[model samples]
Structure formats: C-alpha cells, structure tokens
Target: MAEHPAYPVGLRLAGRRVVVLGGGQVAQRRLPALIAAGADIHLVSPQATPSVEAMADAGEIAWTRRPYEDGDLADAWYALIATSDQGANTAASAEAERHRVWCVRSDDADAATAWTPATGHSEGVTVAVLTTDARGRDPRHTAAIRDAVVEGLRDGTLVAPHHRTRTPGVALVGGGPGDPDLITVRGRRLLAEADVVIADRLGPRDLLAELPPHVEVIDAAKIPYGRYMAQEAINNALIEHAKQGKSVVRLKGGDPFVFGRGMEEAQALAEEGIACTVVPGISSSISVPGAAGIPVTHRGVAHEFTVVSGHVAPDDERSLVDWPSLARLTGTLVILMGVDKIGRIAETLVAHGKPADTPVALVQEGTTAAQRRVDATLATVAETVREQDVKPPAVIVVGEVVNVGVQSSPKTSE
Candidate 1:
C-alpha cells in the first residue's frame, strides 16, 4: 500500500460544521473529537447507533435520519465518510467535492483532504500522531503506535514536553460507574493528594472516607431531575479553589466526558489559562450492563448496541431519534437517565413495531451495593418502574438478551 500524504497544517475545527456519513462505532469514536473541537456536527445516516442518538439528544450534534444526499454537504465545512459501504463512501466523497467541501473518506485514505490523527491530551496540551511518508505504514499500525506512545506517556516513562509543568493544582476525576475498585490508579493517587474534596452524590461514599480527616469536604451533588448548582457555578467553584492553590478534587461518577460535563469545565479552565489534566475513567454505559449479567453485544443476539440518554430538554423540538429503525433492528438498546421517560420510550418502541412483550430491565445503581433490578415487558416497564419508584442513575436494557436475564432468574422470583 502507498503512504498517504499528510497535510502541512492541522486545521482547528472549532465551531465548524462537519458532517459524518455513518452511525457506527467508527463514527462514535470520531464524534467525540469533533465535539471536543466545538464542531457543529450533522450526522447523515438512515439510523444512529445508540451513542450517536445520545449525542444528538444532549444537543451535541444534529441528525438527518436519511441516507446521505448530495445536498447534505451544502452547508458542511468538512465531511467524514465512514459508512461500511465503500460505494456509499465514494458517493459521499464525490458529493462533498462537488459542493466544494473538504472530505475524508474512511475507506479511501487518498481521497480524503485530511486523515484524523490518534490524539492524546494532557493539561494545556494535545498530542496528535501522524505518520511521516518515510514510515510508509498502515493506518491501523500507525494508530497502534499512537496508542503505545500515549500509554507510555501516561505511565510517566516517556516525558513529553507538556508533562514537565510543575503547576500545583487538582484534577477533577470521574470515578466511573459504582465500583470503587474500578477507579483509575491515577485517580486514586490524586484523591490521596487532595487538600479539599468536592464530590458528586452518586460516587461511593466509602471512597471519600479514605481521605485524610483534615482535608476539607464539600458536597456538590447534582441529582437528576432535582435542583442543584448550575454547571457554571460548579466550574467557578473548581477554578476558585484551584486559584487559591488548593488541591481540590471535583469527583464525578462515570467517565467525566461521557455525561459528566467535564469537557465544558476543562474548556472554561483553558480560557482562564489554568493548566488542567483529565485521567480517563471507564464509562458505566458498558460496564454497568456487564455487571448485571447483561452483555451489550452477543453473537447473533446482537451485532450492534445503541446507548442513549433518556433525559431530554423540555423545549427541544428535534426528534434526532429514529425509534422505528431501533425497533426493527436486532440489537440491544441501553438507555441512561431513562426512568422519567420510560413510559414514552416504551410506547414509542412498541408503537413502531417492536413487540409489546419485548424484554426490558431497569438496573438501578448498577455495580454498587444498592443495585436493584426490575424486569418487565416493553408494554409494562413504564408502569413497573413507576410502581417500583425507580429513579435516575438507572440503566434500561431492551431487547432479546434481556430475556436471558429474565430466564436466568428463578421463576419463583418473577
């Protein structure tokens, strides 16, 4: 294979309109970078995988629930053609070119205006790995090399220029899911070094008990569907505490970027020239379900899985969701923040042709001691959740594999 040429300068896609022409895992991986760059993303696909839909629901991206049309590129500043279909990718590339928009074809590297680099970030810095023509390497191999480089840097064996900063402050870490044991070692070390602790309500309380008694503690819990400090206020507090040279820990449950709004706070700190670092956490979306004996993917049972946020803004009119396609697909659907809208969501799925008796499970406080499971059919899950008073911080798993959980339980329990 011939090496693809590299661009002379990397463009910052901040606030630009970029259209992604797929909705699978590849697109999911790409979506975060575009979002982090503050790109206005319009995803053009007939159906969205769960992560894409969740991003759409969170007002992070726009969705076009139809096949890519030439017109879709009309307003796009750049396009990422990443569908599995090579022909579709070619068509998308042609259309993008016709509309004078820069396009990156995932299936054809040479056709793209720019290739995405495997990127890593530390406080106040981002490192992107791009292959030089001399390397003459496979993109996959390049990505693997990038991962190794990132891992080495993270492990402190490789000293990148940015890591030399001696700035004394705290990094708010996302502890991930409910498993105290799952907290990253780096996060654990940071927790031990903290001068003050401010944590979310959902994380394991026992984890905080380990902190030294003299360390100041503040409760900055934000309950779903309940009154709490606005995100702006939380950011302000973190910055204020850090400015005083206090090592403050703003601990959040789950991967901070997944739904914790860590990015927003990071960006705010960047504007103020405060050095900030993020230690990645395992996301609960996959881990929580696995803990409950539910596999998000299985051979033939599900080739794909979609994760969505059940929480929606009251005034948003865009239905970024394609319930009908989701209903028809043979895959698993996982929903977070779905307790309140369980009734509406169940109704939509059933109304769109999913069986009324489709298996559904509401796993509450997953991976924690308080974990609870409520099982019901699609038609009755809403009522079941209401009757049981199941609340947020719960995950809803829908599809055939749900039946596995139902069957595994003792019949007498049901």
Candidate 2:
C-alpha cells in the first residue's frame, strides 16, 4: 500500500463545501474542524449524536438523515467517510473519487486523498505531525505524541518553523492547576508580550503580576461554580481585541483542551478566518496528586490511570462511565468537578467491588501556596470532604497510591 503524502503547506479550508458522511462520535469530532474552517458542511448519516443533532437543529449545517448516495458527492470540495461500517465507507470513498473530490475514508487507509495530521496551532502558524505510515494509528498513541510535541513547544525545546520576518501575536495560555512556577515558558513569553491580560478567577494571581505594569489588565474571570460571562461572549472579545492588532492574552486555569472549552473558542476564531494558536497547559488531574506527594502511577501500585468528569448529564447515560472496571483495575482514578457527586461515586465504586476501605484523597487548591490535602477511605471520603471543607478546583485520587502521601508526610503545623 502507498503511504500518504505530507503537504509542505497546510491548506486553509475556509469557505469550502465539505461533506461528512457519518453521525457517530468520530464524525462529530471531525465536524468541528470543518465548521471551524468555515466550510459549508453537508452531513449524511442515518443517526446523529447529541452534538450533531444540536448543530443540525440549530441550522449550523445541512443534514440528511440517511446513508451516503452517489448524489451526495454533488459539488463537494472535500468528503470524509467516518461510518462504523467498512463497506459503507468504501462506497463513499469510491463516490468521492468519481466526483473528483478530496476524500478521507475512516476505515480504508489507502483510499484517503489526504491524511489528517495531529495538528497544533499558535497564532497563524499550524504544526502538524504526520506518521510515515498513512494507516491511522491508535488515538491514545496519537494523543500522547501530540502532548509530547505540545510540551516541547511549551518548554521552548521544540522551536516551530518561524518566519522571523513576521512577529507572532500574543497567546493566551492556561497555566494549569496551580503552581505559579509551573507556567510554560511560551506562556511566560506571551505574558511578557501581552498588551492586555484577561484571566479566569482560578488562575494564580501572582502569575499575572509577572507581566509588565504598562500592560492593561481585565478581570473577565469565571469560576467553575460562580457566575461569569458566557463562552460565546468571551470568544467574541478575544477576537475583537486581536482584530484591532493588539496582542491579548485570555488565560485559563488548566490545560485548555481538557474541559476548558478551548476548542470552541478556536473554532469560533477559525470561522472568522482569524488565526489563533493554543498552548496546552498541565492538567490538574495528574499534577495535583503529584504536588500532594502522591504519584498517579507506581510500580505494583498502579498500572493505569483514568481521568473523568463528575458533572455530566444524568439523562445522558452514555456520559456516565463504567465504575466497575475502574474499581476493579489496579490503578489510580482521578475525578474532576466531582466533589458534589462524591457520595454517589463512592457508592457506585463500593457496589462495583472496590473495597470500602480503599484509600482516597482530596487535594484542594493543588500546586498553590494555599493548598490543602484531606485523606480518607472510599467508605468515608464524602464525610471527610465535608468535614474538611474540600471544594472545587480540586482533584479526587482513589487507589493504593493514595496511601503514599499519608506515609510520606511528616506532621506539620495545621
């Protein structure tokens, strides 16, 4: 099989007609890119995810509730077939070729006209990672590689190809969980260049002081549990300032991609054809435990770690996770935004065969000067949290590794 070719220059698919023939999670994931590229998207699928249905209901894209037909390729500049059915995907790819449209077949690696690279964007520049083998690898591996590249850029070890002739604009970075010193070097540089700074309520205030005094500051901050500006308004403000050619920073608390809604803002900017880049930050899920003297993974203690959100919809049962596998695994489990659901979560874990006596720890304001740690067992974590006043912007770590902190910490002044 022939390998896919890498493009010397990334194509800006703005204002193109892109047809996506699937409505599953994979299709839903790809839709954002097409929408962000300002494509006139025509979706053909027998079923749709909530996100897809929402977009279609809002009239954001044209939708056909059926499988792809030959006529579905009419006037499309690009086509993506992401159905679970391999035969359906092959047929769609064949149709795309007949219409001379650029095509990507999710199931058939050799049939794609172009491969979707693991992309990272900053300002107008886009860095894409393309494996030599066109066969799409596992997403978990792809994510790991993307993370490594992002970390390299953050630390200045991976210097992207820069046209020094063009000065880059400011990037708003999520400094991650807490530790002020944990701020990425790229984030620090952007802070230095920022003509204006807008930050979230949870971000370390001391980190903001690092900026030059001449820089204007705005406190359009939002707390996870507090009132704040809607994300749409925030997106508009960021673009409006950038459109004025002013370097602006809209800093968040943690890694922007991990539940920070960074992709939504990125999509909004892409829709307007405004170039913006995302600088990934350390997520609290792993870092918080590390700061609390707990390693997420330890030999013979934990072999895997699963990170999940606690605030998913109740009616959306799909969002609810498999507590049994998580409980049975000999690994660490971290839950974010789950303080309120601690009781129910504990019940589920216990019912699913996790020992009621399994160690659990709640680390609040992690990585900051005012950090606090509350230790308890699976049976008593909910009560312990209430007694200790553990709050949001915190991480709940459950597993054998949770005992590491208790054993390591010496008695200190309360």
TM-score (all chains, Cα) for each model: 0.56, 0.57
Every candidate's CA RMSD: 14.6, 14.3
lDDT by residue (202-235, candidate 1, tens digit) is 6656688777677787777642334435677777
Clashes of each: 2, 3
Which stretches of candidate 2 lie above 4 Å from their native place? 1-170, 222-229, 313-320, 411-414
Residue 216 lDDT (model 2): 77
Residue pairs with backbone overlap in model 2: 121-277, 122-277, 123-277
For all candidates in order, the CA lDDT equals 0.77, 0.77
